[model samples]
Target: MASSSVAGEPKQSRPGFFKRSVQFFKDAWGELKRVRWPNRKELTSYTMVVMGTCIFIILLIFGFDLGISYVLELIGLR
Candidate 1:
């Protein structure tokens, strides 16, 4: 008995490393081209929002750490 391929077409082998790498970059560039990049004003606004959130989180964590340290000192744990 012999195995039969679909539609009488032979299976194709995978491309080599260099060919695959080149194809990957081509696909990536195509996707990047389709992206909606932010303008300068939007970029600045986004940056400021991120910075403000980070500062708020940093202050929150700092406050928690100070409160914990104070309690530990009162109990002579540190």
Candidate 2:
């Protein structure tokens, strides 16, 4: 069950497993070369933004937890 080339050349009869691994890596590496990687300043800014957002969410969750605990304690729910 092998494929033939357009010129009637019998395709390489390699095993049916992972047919295009090398091709996939080559294509991926090519794409990686095309990427415009972020500069240090941009990376720092992005990281800071992400950190600030995480801190805000954590603070919000902490406040909610404290409020719920206080209410539960007042009702003798431990």
Point out where model 1 deviates above 4 Å.
1-11
Query: Candidate 2, residues 1-78: lDDT per residue as tens digits?
Result: 554566666667775557578778889999999999999999999999999999999999999999999999999998
Q: State which candidate has the highest lDDT.
A: 1
Q: What is the lDDT of residue 51 in candidate 1?
A: 100
TM per prediction:
0.83, 0.71
lDDT values of the candidates? 0.96, 0.90
The per-residue C-alpha lDDT of model 1 at residue 32 equals 100
Model 2 stretches astray by more than 4 angstroms: 1-15
Scored by TM-score, the top model is 1
Error of 2 at 72 (Å): 0.8
Supply every candidate's count of residue pairs whose N, Cα or C atoms clash at under 3 angstroms: 0, 0
